[model samples]
Target chain A: MAKKSIKIRAKVKEDIVTVKALMTHPMETGARKDKSGELIPAHFIQEVVCESGGKTILTADWSGGVSKNPYLSFKFKGASKGDMVKLSWADNKGKSDSVEAKIG
Target chain B: MNLKRRIVLKGTAAASAIGVAGLLAPRAVLAAWPEAAFTAKTVPEALEALTGNSAASESGDIKIKAPDIAENGAVVPVTVTTSIEGIQSISVIAANNPVPLVASYNMGEGALGFVSTRIKMGKSGDVVAVVKAGDKLYSASKGVKVTIGGCGG
Candidate 1:
């Protein structure tokens, strides 16, 4: 699979940068069943990390209990316009992707 | 898969070796992922595995923001913020989910005690946010009703 799983936006205002990201995922909780009534195996992002200019700002540990195509937003200090902010995620199945966006 | 993880770890290490700015300062130590905690069957068990405290006291200082009714259990927005100082970590639990523990975050020094994310719900139930601060744990909870079950409901 391609590493195009995340869409991110960041904007800096008054020295603080707010970041919002949308992740593409099924986020299956393992308890879900298909139309055929067979259980769908668990497939969900287990880790997410956000960084600004090569520095880690946030790291998250998640489970199947997280909703599908999860959206996340957070803020950090000391960011400037046009700075690169990268967001990455790793799933329970060992699939992972990362994307970078410039602070607007 | 192992190779991919190894590459990522190597990149992090390389960044640390360069000794970047304060914002990028390498943590003296980062805690290992607590796999056992997230796998716990019960909420108390999960909490005990993560914070060593299953009997966390409820506190008004901790706030959990979630909708009273979630139209889609597949994606419910949840935000947790606390006024407590010296917060060490925050954990989110969806009581009705097959695996109740939704997410957990470790707070580094100078990090804010606030987090916002989307979580899944198998059904209508209480969404709990637990904060560990200086050996004590505090939590806040709010009931959320799911109109469309996320876990094949």
Candidate 2:
């Protein structure tokens, strides 16, 4: 079984829900060379989507310029405590991971 | 001679068919990745591909928060916030990086005009934040000094 790659947290305060997510990825730019001097293929997350209560709230498009183990933070309204928020990301190589957390 | 002309006609038809499909492919996939924009090398080219227009007005409504000096270029924290109403999206561009456009965020209904993330910088440069509101684009930028480059492995 593959290990999970995404960790997410959500908390509601004053009718606003704040979400923070951390994703583990190498985020290779294809410009880097390995110890053997072979060019590493570009492997980076291209899109990240956040949803709450079955509704999409935020969508992010990223390039390889993003740092390794990218961390993202954002906020949205119309959700309350105990509501579920899901964060997902898809890389350029077609790999993806998603995780859900309840608003604290 | 007749067979050669027929083959040329058939090739043209096939090429046009593939061209039409290429134009319609992005729409078929909902929320498809913006490949052209991300792959763009220059800042103006990236902005032009991401937003319809490359011209953006400098505005005080947008705020960019980042360190004046980064000890490590591999993980420089950045946050963009705007008071502009009806924000459609926000994009971060590291002007000196190999690929200037770092990330773009599309806000949904009731979402705030703020985003915080970390980016890699090849060297010291200005970090520009562009906010799209309604049909207008507003931008703000801040300079960050990097002690070590992040791109070279």
Candidate 3:
């Protein structure tokens, strides 16, 4: 499967910062079945981390039970306009994808 | 007369045993919830138990944005927002999902009352949104149909 894309849009009001992101990838836990009763192998994003200027804001460790294309919206303090927000997701097979969004 | 009393007592004891077995039956029956909805099947079950009996309903205050039709079953976009105040959490449940509750976000203190995310849909179904505020439960649901199969099919 292609690596999922993560897009972040920052909604700022006064001193509060809200970051929204969507990652395009299948979080397969290798435990599903098909119409034919065959088992689909497990493929999942095991860890996710969102960062602001070297400070960690959120981290996620997904199990095989997580749905595909995990979407997350989070808030953080201390970030202002033009600051950078980074999102990354890594799979159990050692594959990872990362992207950065400049706060708008 | 003593023999008749003994037989009656045995029947009553047998009936009580059957009653105990009946009460313990439903626990095993609900145990076979879907296996591949996610890595943790317990997540959905726990969320349902948290919000008792409140089914998702439509409201102007709540909006669920996912593609009217999904191109891939493996990845689907979902967003939920509410006009209500003091929101404590926002949770998504796929009404037809094998394990209904997809994810739950416990809001930070004084946090905004909206969230957006992409979730996996094994098949077409309504995405149910549950919001917690004012110490009450509110919900809304939107339908998203998956067009193409994306489950390694």
Model 2 stretches astray by more than 4 angstroms: B1-31
Per-model C-alpha RMSD: 11.8, 10.4, 13.6
| CA-lDDT, candidates in order | 0.77, 0.84, 0.61
lDDT of 2 at B102: 91
Tens digits of per-residue lDDT for model 1 on B3-78?
A: 6854554344223222221222122222355666766767998899888789999999999999999999887999
> By DockQ, who's the top model here?
2
What is candidate 3's lDDT per residue for B71-135, written digit by digit as tens?
97666777787888777767777655444556655565444666666666656778888887766
RMSD to native, candidate 3: 13.6
The CA lDDT at B134 in model 3 is 61
Clashing pairs in 1: A67-B120
lDDT of 2: 0.84
Docking class of 2: acceptable
Please tell me which predicted candidate would have the highest lDDT against the true structure.
Answer: 2
By TM-score, the candidates rank as 2, 1, 3
Give each candidate's interface RMSD in Å: 11.2, 8.0, 12.2
